[model samples]
Target: MGFLQQKNSADDSIVARIATLVLRLILVVAIPLIAFAVLYAGFIFLRDGNAPKWVITAVAIIWGVGGVAALFWIFNWIVELFSDTWRARLQPFVFVGPALAILAWYLAIPVGRTFYISLFDRDGPGTGQFIGLANYATVFTDRLMREAFRNNIFLWIIFAVPLTVGFGLLVAVLADRSRFERTAKALIFLPMAISFVGAGVIWNFIYVVRPPDTEQIGLLNAIIVNLGGTPRFWPAHTAIAPWNNLFLVIIVAWLQSGYAMVLFSAAIKGVPVEILEAARVDGASEIEVFFKIMIPTILGTIITVTTTVVIFTLKIFDVVWVMTGGQFGTGVIATQFYRQSFIARNAGLGAAIAIVLLIAVIPVMIYNLRQFREQEAF
Candidate 1:
């Protein structure tokens, strides 16, 4: 009787484990399916409903965040239901799966599709000739494209990047020494709060010109008038060609300076105070200490900041679109892409330009990843 009882007990224990395993599997599958159904329904409602804009926005935000959170929770809990050995093997993939899926769907797939479309002629992917490298040849050889590349590389990048980074570094250093560091940083960083289009609009008022003797409504024109100077159309006239481009570059610099300042400030703050004191002890002036000690210490952050800004400058569009509509020699690569793709309806050429831009960004991205990995190691 005792032997039979012990055997039965062992069988019962196995049954319970099997039941638990089945329950865990069921929960994993069922939870996600139900969540997906609900999410689909909500998306449809949001798409079709005549609800108040704010109401739709609020619902979308809540559903988006809550749904993702719940899905992650369900997945993690299911993973945790496994034995220690299984859990360890599965947890990383479970947590990382969603992000991988998103990147594959949103980034990798789109890039591949864009490249595929680039091979076709103006009618785009559905019905266009496979032009081989002809579109790319045109991209390089075209007049407007050539001008766009020149403006992007020289005026937008060469001029704006240094000004933004330099001004940011200067502000970061000065703010660090001041008692009102936070306040000063806040004020300087305010430009970053405004959207690029908004900044363009604000600066437009400053650059807006009037008749030479008329009441100058533009702040810049007013100042010029008061100071016994003249206000020309600031974006259109300086010496005819690329000088107008400089004003557009200035807008980008102004907008991005705050971004650079924030990054530089954090990096500057992270420098070991002892090193600065030691440099001073070694007869290094403030200038020498800044250039030698402080800069070297935060070189990684500097590279990161510069690369980030360079990427942004490469893709600049809204500011130029809003202010000059890519007129008056202000067009860059992005604006040129917009003109080709949407404006001119030259889909093939646009795709080639896009591919070129992507190629340009790829090296910078790889370098940035390397820098990030090195920093992560530390």
Candidate 2:
């Protein structure tokens, strides 16, 4: 009788464990489907725009917020259902899966579609008949495309990378030693708060030019006229047309300098003070200490900042679009892509330009990743 009782108790425990596992599995599967269905129904009602206002609000609150919470809860419950070792292995996936799914849907799918669209004729509809490398060939061989590439290179190399990095470093170093460090940094970094289009509009007034006989309304032209100089269409002067790209570059640089300054300032602060003191004790000048010690120590940050700016410059559109509309020799890869795809209705050409821009960015991104890995290892 004692043996039989012990066997019955063990059997009961096993059955309970199995029942719990089944219940957890059911919940994990069913909850997400139910929550998504509710969320979809809410979205449809919202889209139809015929529901009572209060009903719409209630549906949004319940479906959107509650659905997200339920999905997260389901994921957690799944991890909890596993044994300790299994739970440890599965927990990371449970947490990370949703983000991965989102990236695949939004990023990966679009990139694939862009590539697929690039292999067709510009005039053809709906992923036109694949013409292999023709679009790419035209992108490289076309005159306007070549000029756009040149301008993009100029922006990346001359203005975006070097000038922004240099200005940022200069401001950071100066601000660090200033009596009103916070105020100075805040003033300089203020430009970063403005959007590219807004900045473009503000600078447009600065660069604006009217008839030579008329009053100069643009701040820059007004200053020139006050200094007894003739007003000129600064963006369209034949002598300066090629370098007008530099004007757009300057606008981007102004906006981006603040970003670089923040990063560089942080990196400079991270340098060991003892090392600088040692260098100074050895009779090194401030400039020498800065060039030899501070710079080398923050080289990684400089590269990262420069590469990030390069990528931004490569895809620059807003400033050019708003200011010159890609006219006056200010076209960059991004604006060209926009013009080709939407304005000119050349989907294939646009996709090719986009791909080229993507290709240019990949190397810089790889370098950044390597830098991150090395930092982590250190």
Model 2 worst lDDT run, 10 consecutive residues: 3-12
Residue-wise lDDT of candidate 1 within 1-378, one digit each (tens)?
Answer: 454332323334666657646654555455556677879998998999999999999999999889978888877897788866456545665666566656766798988888888898999877888988889999899888888999999888999999999999999999999999999989989998898889988999898898887899899889888999878878877376887899889988888899999999999889998988998998999999988888899999888899999999999999999988888777888999999899899898898899999999999978878879989964
Question: Candidate 2's error at 279, in angstroms?
Answer: 2.9
- State the displacement of the C-alpha of residue 41, model 2, in Å, after optimal TM-score superposition: 3.5
Best-fitting candidate, scored by TM-score: 1
- Where does candidate 2 stray beyond 4 Å? 1-40, 50-66, 74-93, 123-127, 236-239, 369-378
Error of 2 at 80 (Å): 6.0
| Tens digits of lDDT, candidate 2, 232-310 | 7566554776786777778888998999999999998999999999999999999999999999999989988987887
Clashing pairs in 2: none
Q: TM per model? A: 0.82, 0.80
lDDT of 1 at 171: 95
